[model samples]
Target: MDTKQLNYYAEQDKILIATDCIIFGFDNQSIKLLVFKRRIAPFAGKWSLIGSFVKKDESVKNAAKRVLTDITGLENVFMKQLKVYGSVDRDPGDRCITVGQYALIRIEDQDIELVEKHGAVWYDLDKMPDLVLDHNQLVEDALVQLRLKASYQPIGFELLPEKFTIPSLQKLYESIYQKQFDNRNFRKKIIALDILTKLEEKDKTSSKKGAYLYKFNRKKYDKLADAGINFKL
Candidate 1:
């Protein structure tokens, strides 16, 4: 490489790169989002997605993972890249661009103390508060991507426990679609997928009859998934 070629790239205007995470969690009955009060000057005290500027030596994905771990104290969670936001005045402090990423987590698995220590709060998606910058749009975009992915894949499993009741699974689907599903039809459709194994145990917490507990058969699910099985609810 020649010095002139290197200088050519250096002459271009510099802009800051950042990554924002739209962390979604499901409590088996409803979907929730994690937001925090900004601790910096530009939007101090305002609600904002967990985010940070991309470091010079790190990949954007790593930056997002770092931010998620820092804020939620959870690691090894899979994150999906939603889109990039680069509106000229998106950040009041400087010229910047941000990549949006979303991750689905089981609500009970999170470290509540760590989240609260960082001033983060989990808000039900339907009742989310006003957010800073274009965070609201970021969240909306994440939801669209989530819904699309959930229709074609078994991504909802990430939001649930190892063993769950049929009603719990139905509630999860209903929460994702933001509507009620016909119980009988929903059960028939899900059972037809053949991805779950009914356990002998039953959850008696909700009713006298008790619903059977089922575990996702990952081996079978993977085989079917590889065969292009559609997991639409």
Candidate 2:
């Protein structure tokens, strides 16, 4: 490699660091993000990103997982850093580098009561309240990254229930896509993906005209993905 490229890598190796997780949860109808209520902050009681300083003992990703488990009492959720927000005035407290991560988690699977104990709550992405620091920017970047990844991966299903209605699936897409989608085209695309299997029954609780339920066929999606095929709806 060229010496200039080598120098760039060398400088990257010595950057300041921290971790922030934008935990996204699917609540039947919407995509939610996890935010921590700041206990000690210039903006106390106001919503802020879930975060931690990058300690000498753990890598950035591991520190993120640790924060998730410690705060939410949960583990093994899909965690990946989306971007590093390091504007000089981004944080009012001190000079800290915050790397944001987007996580996919099933809301029903978590212990909500315990989560609240840590001052953590799920914020509806559709109407997020004012956030402290550069948290608003973090959410913006995370959503874009998630949409790009979802187009290629079955990650849209990651936050969904095992059995879901087509409307619910469409709602999930609209939540991420942030726009209205034609029902006919959306349904056609979902079926054409062929990774969703129609369940034996329908979810009749919502309406008299029950919507058919479906589940992600991970096995088929995995095999197809392994063959370099992409699934998008």
Best-matching candidate per TM-score? 1
Model 1 C-alpha lDDT per residue in residues 133-186, reported as the tens digit of each score: 999999999999988898998888888888899999999888888889999999
Off by over 4 Å in 1: 1-8
Model 1: per-residue Cα lDDT at residue 117: 92
Local accuracy of candidate 2 as per-residue lDDT tens digits, 1-233? 56665545555545457888888998877789888788776788988888888888889999999888887777888888798788877777777788898888888888878897887878788677788888888888999999999889878888887899999989998888778899999999888878889988899988998999998998988888988877666
Clashing pairs in 1: none
Candidate 2 local Cα displacement, residue 52, angstroms? 1.3
TM match of model 1 to true structure: 0.94
